[model samples]
Target: MDFVNEDIDNYAYDHTQIEDDLLWRLELETYDQLEIPQMLTGRIEGRLLKMLAQLVEAKRIIEIGTFGGYSALSMAEALPDSGYLITCEMDPVAIQFAQRFFDESPHGKKIVLKEGPALDTLKTLTGSFDMAFIDADKENYLNYYEALLPLMRPGGLIVVDNVLWGGRVLNPQETSDHAIHRFNHRVKDDHRVEKVMLTIRDGVSLLRKR
Candidate 1:
C-alpha cells in the first residue's frame, strides 16, 4: 500500500535536510521498541511539518495525535522562543513513549501533552491556535476538522495527515479509507478555505482558513 514510490521517496530523503540528533535517536528507539514504528512520521513528513511551522511563524500549535512525538518535536523545534505546542494522545503507552523523548529534548518544555480523547481535549481548550495538525482516528476526520476550525486563528493553517489512506482512498476498500475519501471530498468542497492536497508521505492536506 505504498502510495509513494520507494526509490523516489528515498532519493528525496537523501537530498533533504537531515534530522537532528534527538530526532535520529527517537527514530531509532521507535524501531527498537515499538510494534508499529511506521506510525512515526519519519524524516520527510517531519521536516515538512517543521518547515510549515516556520512559514506560519507559529506561536502555538495543536497536534491531535502525538504518536511517538516525532511531528510535535519537529514543529516544536521551529517555534520561536515564546512559542508553545499542545499534543494530544489517548494511548497511555504512546504518551509515555512520546514523553520520554519530549523530556530529553529542549523543545519538550514548549510541548503540552494532553492525554485523552482529542475531541474532549479540544473542547476544553480556549483561544485560537496558530496551527493545528490532525492525524488521529480516521473515522472522526471531519469532526476533528470542525472542532478545530473554529478554534484556529483567522488565516491559520490546518494540516491533516493520511488523507490518502495508502492510495485506498481512491478505491475506498475499507471503512477507514471510505471515511478518508469522504473527508477529502468535504475539504475539497469547503468554500471557506484554500486547500492543497499533496502526495507527501501517505497524503497531506494543507488548509488556510479565510
Candidate 2:
C-alpha cells in the first residue's frame, strides 16, 4: 500500500537526519510499549513538523492528536519562548503516556494536553490559533477542518496527516480510502483556503486559511 517505491523511501530515510538522542529513545519506547505505535510521528515527519512551526513562527498551536506526544514535542521545540501548543487526545491511556514525556522535558510546560474527543474540545476553543496539526479520526477530517477554520487566523497553516491512508486513497474500494478521497476532493474546491497534498510519511495535506 506504500505509494512511494521502497528503494526511494529507503533513500529518503537515509538522506534525512535522524532525530536527537532523547527523541529517538522516546520514539523507540513508544513503539515498544504502545498498541498503535505507527501513529507516532517518526524522525522524518517530526523534523518536518518542527521546520514548519519554525517557518510560521507559530506562537499558538493546536494538535488534534497527541500520540505519545512525539509530534507535540517536536513542534514545541521549534516554538519561541512565549509560544504554546495545546494538544488533544481522545484516549486516556495515550494521554497518560504522552504526559509522562511532557513532564520530563523543558518544553513540557508549553504543552497542554486535553483528554477527550478532539472535535468536541475544538468547538469550545475561542481564541485564534497560528497553526494546527490534524491527525485524528479519518471520518471526521472534513469536520475537523470546518471546526478549526473559524479559529485559524488568515495565513495560518493546518496540516492534516494520513491523508493518503496508506495509499488506500488511490483505490476506490476501501471505505476509508473513499472517505479520504472525498475529503481531498472537498478541500481542492474550497474557496476559503489554499492547499497542497505532500507525499510525506503518510501524505500530509497542508492548508492555509484565507
Candidate 3:
C-alpha cells in the first residue's frame, strides 16, 4: 500500500511545509471526530494541492469531494480574493462537518459547497475551470473524468485521488478496485489529455486537457 518506505514518508512529511494553524486544527479534529479521518488530505498532499492551484493560476476551481474541507481549503488558499471554488458533496454528514471548518477559515469564503450527487452538481455547473480535484466515490471515477474533461480549459489540470486504492489497483478484485483501474486506463488512453500518475498517498493522477 505504501508506495514509498515508511521512513521516507515520514521524512517527506517532516520536510514539507507545515500546514497552517487552521489546517492543523482541521486535521486534528477530523481524526478525533470523523470515522475515516485518513480521508483528510493531510500535510504533504494538501501542500501539493495548493501548489497545483497556484501553478495553474487557478481562479475558478471545481472539487468533486469536500471530505473534511482540508483539500478545498488548501486549494482555496491559493486563489485570489475574487476567485472562488465550487465543491460538490452528496453526504449531509460530511457537508456539515466540512462546512464548520470552512466557516472558521478566512479562505472558506472562497468555497461554495454544493449539496447533492456530484454528477447532478456537475451538470448544473457552467464555464471553464482552471483546475479540478476529484476525490469522490471510486465507482464513478470514470464518469467524473468524462464529465469534467470537457469543462477544463486547455492546459488546465485535473487531479484524481486514490488511484492506487491502497494497492488494490494492481490485482483488482473488488468493484471499487476495478473501477479505479478502469479509470486509470481510460485516462491513459484518452488523447485529449496528457496524464501522469504519481505514487503519492494512495496514488494521484494528474491529467492535463490538451
Candidate 4:
C-alpha cells in the first residue's frame, strides 16, 4: 500500500532543501547502475541522516547496510574532523559502487567499509559508537539491534530504516514483512531505549538509548 500521497511526497521534495552536487550524482548513478536502485537513500532521507549525525555531534557512526554509499556519505559529511564511520555491506557491487564515491568525497577518509554479514561484523567491532544506522536485511533486524545495542554508548542513537516495509507491516503476510513487524514490536517493548517511528519513505524508527 502507498504510505503517503504521491502528490504530497512530490511537494515535500520540491520545497525541501536540495542535495549537493555529489549527492545528486550518487542518486542518479545508483538508479542508472544498480539493480535495486530504490534502496538508495535518495536526497530527502539522506539529508535526514546527515542532519541527525550533526545534531548528535556523532564522532563514531556505524551503518549496517551500505547500498551505493549515499547514506554513509551523507552522514559522513556531517561528522566532525576526527569522526569516523563504519558501514557494512554484503554485496560486492554495492561495496565497489559506494567506494568509488566515498574516495571522491572530502569526508571519504572518515568512512570505513566492511563487506560481510552485518551481524558478524558487529561482533568483531569494538568500542562504543555514538550512532548506528540499520538498513540491512529485514530478517535480521532484531539480531542487528540486539548485537549493536551493547556497542552503543549511553544516549547514542539508532536509526532503523524500512520499518513499515512499504506498508506491508500492517498485515505482514510475507516473511520480510513479519520480521519487520516483530522487530518494531521488540523496539517498542524494549525498556533500554525510547523510539519514535516516522512515515518517511518506507518508514524510519529513531531510537535513543537511555
Candidate 5:
C-alpha cells in the first residue's frame, strides 16, 4: 500500500532536486545487480537525508543499515572534510557492493562501513552522534531505537525509514508490520525525544532528542 499516491510520488520525484552523477550511476547499478533494489534509498529520500544531515550540521553520524550504501553516501555528502560516518551492515554481499561505490564517491572517505550485526556494532562504537539513520530489518526497529537513543546527543536527530511498512501498520499481519507498529507507538510514547511521522516514501519518522 503506497502512503503517497503513485502519480504524486512520481511528480515529487520529478520536481525534487537531482542527485550527482555518481549517485545516479549507483542507483542504476543497484537496480541492475540487486535482487531487492527497492532497498536503495532512491533520489527523494536520499536528498532528504542529505538535507537533514546538513540541517543538523552533523559532524558525527551513524547509520543502522547500509543497503547498497545509497543512504550512507547521501548523508556523507552533507559532512565536512572532518566529518565522520559509521554505517553498520551484516550482509557480506551488500557490504561488498556498497564498498565499491563508497570507494568511488568523493564523500566516501567520511564513511566507514562496519561489518557485523548492527546491535553488536553499536556496542563497540563510542561518542555521541549528531544524527542517525535507521533503515535496517523491521523486526529490530524498536531494538535499534532503544540502543541508538542513548548514543544521540541532546537535540540530535534520528531519522527512521519505512515506519509505515508499506501501510501495513494500519492493519498489521506480518511480524515485520507488527514490529514497525510497535516501534511507532514506542517512539510516540517516549519522553526523551520529540517525534513526528512524515508521509514521505514508506513513512519516515524524525525524532529529535530532548
Candidate 6:
C-alpha cells in the first residue's frame, strides 16, 4: 500500500523544480557505472538539498553516504565561498567514483570526502554544524540521528533521505520499512527536536534540533 495516493504523489513530483544539465549528466553516469544506482540521490532531491543549504546559508555541512557525491556536490554548489561540506562514505568504490566528479567541479575544494564507516567518522567530528544529510544504512537511522543531534546547533537542519524505503514503510512487512517506520515515529515524539517527514523521493524526514 502506498502511503500517499498515486494522483497526489504524481502531482507533487510534477510541481517540483527540475535539475540542470550537469546534475542530469551525473545522474545518468551514476546509473551507468554504479551497481546500486538507486542509492544515488536523484535530480529532484538534489535540487531540494541545494535549496535547503541556500536557505540556511550553511557554513559547515555533514553528509553520511556520499554515493557518487551527487547530493554532496549539489549542496556544495549552493554554499558560499567560505562554506565547507564534510561527506563520508564506507564504500571505497563509490568514493572513488564520487571523487572523480568532485575533482572536476569548482566547488570541489569545499567538499572533503572522508572514506570510512560513518559511525566512526561522526565520533571524530566535534562542535556544532550548520546542517547534515543522512542517507546511509537504514537500520541505523536512529543511531545516526542520536550521534548527530548533539553536534548540530539549535535550529540546524538535518535532512534524512529514503525514509519511506520505496513506500515499504506503509506495508509493515519489509525489514527496512519497519526500521524507517520506527525511526519516523521516534523522531515525531522526540522532545529534543521538531520534524516533518515529507514524501520527497522515497521520503525525507527533515529535523531541526530544538
Per-model RMSD to reference: 1.0, 1.4, 0.8, 1.0, 0.9, 2.3
Better of 1 and 2 by TM-score: 1
**What TM-score do all the candidates reach, one by one?**
0.97, 0.94, 0.98, 0.97, 0.98, 0.91
What lDDT tens digits, residue by residue, belong to model 4 across residues 75-107? 998898899999999999999999999999999
lDDT of 1 at 53: 93
Summarize candidate 5's per-residue lDDT along 78-187 as a digit string, tens digits: 99999999999999989999999999999999999999999999988776999999999999998888888889999999999998888799999999999999999988
Weakest ten-residue segment in model 6 by summed lDDT: 1-10
Extract clashing residue pairs from model 5: none
TM-score of 1: 0.97
Residue ranges of candidate 3 with Cα displaced over 4 Å: none
Report the lDDT of model 1 for residue 167.
86
**lDDT digits (tens) for residues 1-210 of candidate 1:** 346679987899999899999999999998998768888888989999999999999999999999889999999999987899999999988899999999999999999999999999999988689899999899999999999988899889999999888888879888898899999999999988899999888889999999
lDDT for each of the candidates? 0.91, 0.88, 0.93, 0.92, 0.93, 0.87
Tens digit per residue, CA lDDT, model 3, 115-176 = 99999999987769999999999999999988998899999999999999999988999999
Candidates 3 and 6 compared: the better one by lDDT is 3
Total clashing residue pairs per candidate? 0, 0, 0, 0, 0, 0
RMSD of 4: 1.0
